[model samples]
Target: MTTPRRFDGRRALVTGGSRGIGEGIARRLAAEGAHVIVAGRSLGPAQEVAGEIGGSAVQMDISDAEATMAAVAALGPLDVLVNNAGFDDFAYFTDTAPQQWRALLGTNLEGMFACTHAALPAMQQAGYGRILNIGSEAGRIGSKGNAVYATTKAGIIGFSKSIARENARYGITCNTLAVGPIDTPLTDAARAVPVHGEKMVQAMKDGTLLRRLGTTEEVGAAAAFLCAEEASFVTAECLGVSGGMGISA
Candidate 1:
């Protein structure tokens, strides 16, 4: 018996791969024999993770379209692109400032768009690609104080579906990995708020059939499966990595 090395001879790039869920995805793909590039805004962490995983690292702030494209271009050709770079903060809509909303959309939605736009040409030229967008369950069910973040995530599903419809003929499959409350730094920060910290954690545990927050490794495994050769026929779909948190996004 032999374990499958699913991503052998492929090139993969994961944004925000320096830590948390992004790092987990990068590690998983690399483990499966993909030539992984861990990209993010923080150089040190990205480099560290890349080194540990025997991959490459780049400093890219996905919100900046020009810089993000330039960075992606430098990687030459990519077989897999994981738009895992994202940020969030918990706040009621009334308290949400215009700048905060813009920034959230910039990172969560705009960044994914920019990266995909840049990567697709190369993928199209080769007639092959796997683009995965990391989404949130908040987008499907809506979170109380995370409307802005939720909006961007919801936007991701629509964006991915549109892209899938447009590019599937070219053998490019675009999908969204709608996730639940994972134990990432972003989630921890959101849950640490002075007002709803405990409440949020309790709610997540109660709502999830798993009865606990998901792990980065769990996210990685599910995402890896989607990117594998076996899932070629899958496109225009939102696969939930949530622990039975929702039916669909």
Candidate 2:
């Protein structure tokens, strides 16, 4: 059977599209016939992914409001916008300093604000759009070591809902994808830490009903569905691609 090209003529921008979950989403959209622009902090990696996927690349540090705004504006209008760029570190609330909190907030939360703000006008004008924000299950059920990161994810849920409400009349949909343990570079790095790395990984796996980590492709599939035209009725919802995390077996 042939895969449906849900985004045959759409234009999509996936922030942090150079690697991990972002990269996965970009590839999925492109596979479905969308012209994707892979945005990242570095030009090299973004270009690499875009080249492979027959998409395009742009350097966008969403944390820099000015740069993000300019970059999105240059693209004219987009049919899909995936606010997947984010940063996080495993540290207890008390152990983290102000700078650490700022770093997390800037990219995970404020960055979403800048990118969404920049893209909303065009989406509204077009009267059709799909906005997907990458959140975390940690946001729904707080994690032990990711206090600030959880906070940002929680904020994303609220942000998505508000955006959905405001843009519904324009035929635009906004939703959050709250993911669980996924085998990505970020997770690998966390598990590479000297003492607690393996323990942390095991704990996360154990917490999920699946008793294992998820795959990037899994996330990509979920995102594709939510962003598809068939999902026109779905908006302001938080969909969990979380391997049943936080659920009792």
Candidate 3:
């Protein structure tokens, strides 16, 4: 079966598009006929993904406010912006240090703010845009060791809603995807630890109704729909792509 070119002639920018969920979304968008700009901290990985997808690459470390704003501003008119770049570390609230908090907050929340702010002007000028922020189920249900990370994800929901409300008049839609545990390089590294890794993996699976972690492709598919023109009316919403992880909660 042939894929539909819903984004034909449209341009999209996916931050952290070097690997994992970001890479997945980039590939999906490209497959559906969108010109994707793969942005990441490193140039090589981003270039590789862009090469594979027939797109372009940009070095964008979202945590650097000035650099992020400048890089995004240089993108010209962007039809879609996926705030997928984020940092996460496992630690209880009491155990987390101020430095750790700063790192996560800077990369996840502040970085999103910068990129969105920079992209809004172009979208507003065009009077058409789709913004998809990658959140996490942890934000909604809370995670034992990811307190700061969860906090950042929760902020994303509120941020996206406000952006939607303010930009709807300009034909821009902003939404978030509350993601669940997915099979990504990050998860793989976590699961490589001897005993704790096994237990953590099992717990994540047990939390979901599907009894398994989700895939990057699965996330990409959900993200694609929310960012597509068909979802013009679906602004300020937080869609779960979590394999029913918090269905009861």
Candidate 4:
């Protein structure tokens, strides 16, 4: 018996690969033999992760169109692009300021659009590509205090579907993985808040059928599968890694 080489000779670009789910995905891809390139707004952390994973690093703010395009162009052709760079501002819609909303949309929605647009030309020319967007379960079922965050994730689903419809003919597939509460640096910060902090952990555990939160490694596995050759036929789909929490939708 022989082990499978899932991504041998493949090239991948993973945004926000410095830590958490993104780091897990980048590490997995590199382990599977993909030449991975990690991009982030910060260089130091990105470099550290890249060094650890034996991958290359590039510093670019995905929210900036020009920067994203330029960075993607420099990467030349890519077999897989993991749009994992995202931020969340959790608040009631009324509490969110104009600037905050703009910033959220800029980083979450516009940033993804720019990277996808920039990667399309090369993918189309090559006749194959895989694009995986990291979304959230908040989008699947609207969150009370996460209105803005939900909106952006919902936007990702729509954008991915549109990409699938338009690019399937070019051998390109786009999909969104709406993740549940995973143990990550971001979540740690959220847990520090006094109001809904402890409640969050309890709710996440009690709300899910699994009675536990998901992990970065689990999400990484799902991501690797989505970007694998086996998933070539799957597109325009929103897959939930949400421990059955998203089953309500």
Candidate 5:
């Protein structure tokens, strides 16, 4: 069990916190006594989550650079930042459209840059911060027909490492959690269509040594650990919570 008051008095902003893994992370942090802000593209879901967790809500689209930066600035200062906003379009590299690539990259990789850029200064001034990025095992070991998504997640790891190295002196630690297949909104949608859904289900079973998909709360637990004080010495790392999926790759 997590110790009580682990994050007491700290403020954490979790992008995409309205549902799924992001919501799980927000709830976990809030339960641990952090003043969590559930930020998302829309207000209703975010508000629902915030209310349930006794946290706050912000409607901020991380893909929109200016708006995301503005929203972060308005938050004043934050003790923790979880870059969990991302989208994936499954298709072979040759069939992937330019629009899809743009949209995917905009949210997956660029969103990280925008939010981190805005939040870092405050962490620097305060001499402490925890930045946990939600990545994917698909990026570590490229998946079939998921090239764009994999590329973006791989970028997340590299970018976070650089941030950790540069800001370590200021006591701001940045790390990435490359997560495994989880029951998220995105996956749920994919798992709805009978043909592709069955394929996806089988893939999860075959890819993971555990022979089962993971849970959002499991991902949240890893995120909470990396963001907590106990993980101060664990920056610039890509911790794979992939249920043995990325053991070799």
Candidate 6:
């Protein structure tokens, strides 16, 4: 007998899938035979990524609760939902403004909640769903100049566990992947500066067990497996895609 395709006939929605890790995950899912829907704040970038992968694209800001809900409703039943959209502000806790905190948390935690809440009904009705949240190593071990970012990522782990426990009976799996540093546009932009950029890059490399940053392909592989049918038994767990760096939370 032929082996089953991990995600054959499946439909997946990946938020912030226009670029970076999100885009990588989207492409990986599609390669595994799932119909991927890429969503992001901008249509141009999202559509470009989708076109490259032969997937569909939808412009949305996950930070907006109403927009997230509407997008979920419009997508209907989904076999997989990757909550990869998130926001971060590299600031000391003392320097973080109240408004910035709200914005950061809104996109990272609240936005995730809205999307997951909206997707629940469809998943419950369908009786099969995979939910993967893109978290960070900083969430697990904490980091300097990124207190809010760390907290928000940490929140995702807790939130995902709760959802997993509640939905286990419904054949729904919710898990978070705590990713380490990777070479991406985000990092590139940060490093474009002088002192701060250099420091960030060196610190990332030093913190990693591999002494090198992670790759988009590596993260994509992990995401693909989590969203696969074979991973049904895996839920309420935090998987570290980090190169043996920070490994808790």
Stretches of candidate 1 off by over 4 Å are: 1-3
Off by over 4 Å in 2: none
Q: Which pairs clash in the backbone of model 5?
A: none
Return the TM-score for each candidate structure. Answer: 0.97, 0.97, 0.97, 0.96, 0.97, 0.95
- Model 6 is weakest, by summed lDDT over 10 consecutive residues, at 1-10
lDDT score, candidate 5, position 241: 87
Error of 5 at 186 (Å): 1.5
Residue pairs clashing in model 3 are none
| Per-residue lDDT of candidate 4, residues 151-171 (tens digit) | 999999999999999999999
What's the CA error at residue 113 for candidate 5, in Å? 0.7
lDDT of 2 by residue, 155-198 (tens): 99999999999999999999999999999998998798788889
* Residue 112 C-alpha lDDT in model 3: 94
Steric clash pairs (candidate 1): none
Residues 1-249 of candidate 6 have per-residue lDDT tens digits of 432357778999999999899988998888878889999899999999999888899988988898789888898889899999886666668977999989989999988998899999989998889999999998899988788889899999999999999999899999999998888887786576556877887788889889888988899999988889988789998889889887444
Candidate 3 Cα deviation (angstroms), residue 128: 0.3
In candidate 3, what are the lDDT values of residues 1-249, reduced to their tens digit?
777788899999999999999999999999999999999899999999999999999998888988899999998889999999996887568977999999999999989999999999989999999999999988889887789999999999999999999999999999999999899987786677565777777888899989899999899999999889999889999988888986854
State the TM-score for model 4. 0.96
- The digit string of per-residue lDDT tens for model 1 on 1-249 reads 453699999999999999999999999999999989999798999999999989999999998988888778888989999999998878889988999998998889889888988899999999999999999888888888889999999999999999999998899998998899898898788778898888987797777888898999899999898888789999988988889998533
Q: Could you tell me which 10 consecutive residues in candidate 5 have the lowest summed lDDT?
A: 189-198
Query: Which is the better candidate, 4 or 5, if ranked by TM-score?
Result: 5
Model 5 agreement with the true structure over 151-242: per-residue lDDT tens digits: 99999999999999999999999999999888888787657755677697678768998988888889888888999987889999999887
How far out, in Å, is residue 130 in model 4? 0.3
lDDT of each: 0.90, 0.92, 0.92, 0.89, 0.90, 0.88
Q: Ten-residue segment with the worst summed lDDT in candidate 3?
A: 189-198
RMSD of 1: 1.3
